[model samples]
Target: MSDFLQQVVIGVQLGSIYALIALGYTMVYGVLRLINFAHGDVFMVGAFVGFYAARALKLEEQPTLAGALITLLPVLLLAMVACAVLGLVIERLAYRPLRRAPRLTALITAIGVSLFLENAGQLLFGADPKFFPSVTPQGAGATLNLGGATISKDQLVLVVAAALLMAVLWYIVQRTRIGRAMRAVSHDADAAALMGINTDTVIAFTFGLGAALAGAGGMLFAALTYAKILPLMGIAIGLKAFVAAVVGGIGSIPGAMLGGLLMGLSESFVRGSGFSRWTEAVAFVLLIGVLLLRPAGLLGRFAPEKV
Candidate 1:
């Protein structure tokens, strides 16, 4: 039972990160109906940004609670802002011109952009992996044992922070004016434009918003879970998040969250079962199973295309 509980905690922690990244995928798809393949690389960029920010701030040198708080907050904000700007730039320069082109054209361009970012990351940050500095204060909150399962303060912080971000996102989507315009554009860009909504602006905002979430996920993953940073790190994680989005219903925010949790739990249980080698493959297996059983995903609605 303790073992089971431990896996659950670990699963939820991992799920939270996946959920953050998956939200980006779902949001962009919701508005543009286009998958931004470079999103994971954007996540990678966020992690790097956080890494540099932490170093510049000399966070590792300060081991006090106040120092940790200062380090964590600033690093997160900096990563998010930088990624958001990158997202806007990508939308303006790479995707906007292809908006009216065939879907295939946009998709290919997305792939091209992904490759460009990956190579650019290598050129700029080098192909070697860098260690991410710790932002959690020493001995802060210690490790708590819950029902024979132990969890660190960092993990707790990661989960709570993710939840807060998700809540903010939900509010923006359900209650804000920009969110309404986003929804309108998603439903029908032409109609939204006719209704006097700025479709282009909404679309760009969607990209920026999604990218910002991905950035947060990147920072959290680096600071809390894995401390290794690399240029190509986003490739695998991005694919998994993309799988989560597909499994949750590509354009549904709630679906993306559910899918991310499910993916994380599934992977955790697989590792716990002593099949760590299969951990990476499990995401795709779950995706295939979901598609076979429910093509629209666990929470997604299927809409028939007009011929």
Candidate 2:
């Protein structure tokens, strides 16, 4: 029972990071029907931004609670802002021009953008892995015992922070005026534009918002889970998050969250079962299973396309 609980905690922690990234995938697909393959690279950029910001602020030198908060807040905000701007630039330059073009054109351009970011990141940040500064004062060994299971402070902080961000996102999507416009655009771009909503603005905003979430996820993953950052790091993580989005029924916010949790739990349990070698393959297996069983995903509804 304790082992089960322990795995559950670990799963939730991992799932939170996946959820953040998956949200971006779902949102972009919803609004533009274009999968921004470079999104994961955007996530990588966020981690690097956070890494540099932490170093610039000398965050690692101060381990106190107050110091950690100071380091965390600014670094997170900066990463999100930088990624958001990058997302806008990508949209305006790479995607907007091809908006009316064939879907395959936009997709290939997305892949091209992804490759460009990866190579550019390698050039600018170096291909070497960099150590991420810890925001919490607690040492890595520090953990609390609950019901015979141990949970790290970092994991607790990460879960809470992720929940807060998700809540904020839910509020923005469900209550804000711009959010309504986004939904309108997603439903029917031509109709939304005819109804006086600027589809282009909504599309750009969706990209920026999704990229900001991915940025936050990147920072959290680096600071809390991985403790390292590299130019190529986003590749695997991004792929897994993409799987999560697909499994959760791409374009559905709640489905993305559920899918992320499921993917994390599956990976965690597989590792705990002494099949750690199979952990990497678990995502693809689950994705394949979901695709076979429910083509629209666990929470996604299938819609017939108009001929």
The TM-scores of all predictions, comma-separated, are 0.97, 0.96
The worst-scoring run of ten residues by lDDT in candidate 2 lies at 61-70
For candidate 1, the TM-score is: 0.97
- Clashing residue pairs, backbone N/CA/C < 3 A, model 2: none
> Please, what are the lDDT tens digits per residue for candidate 2 over residues 1-307?
9999999999999999889999999999999988889999999999999899888887763556556666688889999999999999999999999989999999999999999999999999998999886667766555889998999877888888889989999999999999999988888788899999989999999999999999999988888775679998889888888999999999999999999999899989999999999997888989999999999999987867644
For residues 1-307, write the lDDT of model 1, one tens digit per residue. 9999999999999999899999999999988889999999999999999888877877673566556666689789999999999999999999999989998899999999999999999999999898777667646465789999988877888999999999999999889999999888878778899999988899999999999999999998988775689999999889988999999999999999999999889999999999999998888888999999999998888868644
Clashing pairs in 1: none
RMSD of 1: 1.4
- Among all windows of 10 consecutive residues in model 1, the one with the lowest summed lDDT is 61-70
What does the lDDT read for residue 260 in candidate 2? 90
Q: Report, for every candidate in turn, its global Cα lDDT versus the true structure.
A: 0.90, 0.90
Which residues of candidate 1, in runs, are more than 4 Å off?
61-67, 139-141
Q: Count the backbone clashes (under 3 Å) in each candidate.
A: 0, 0
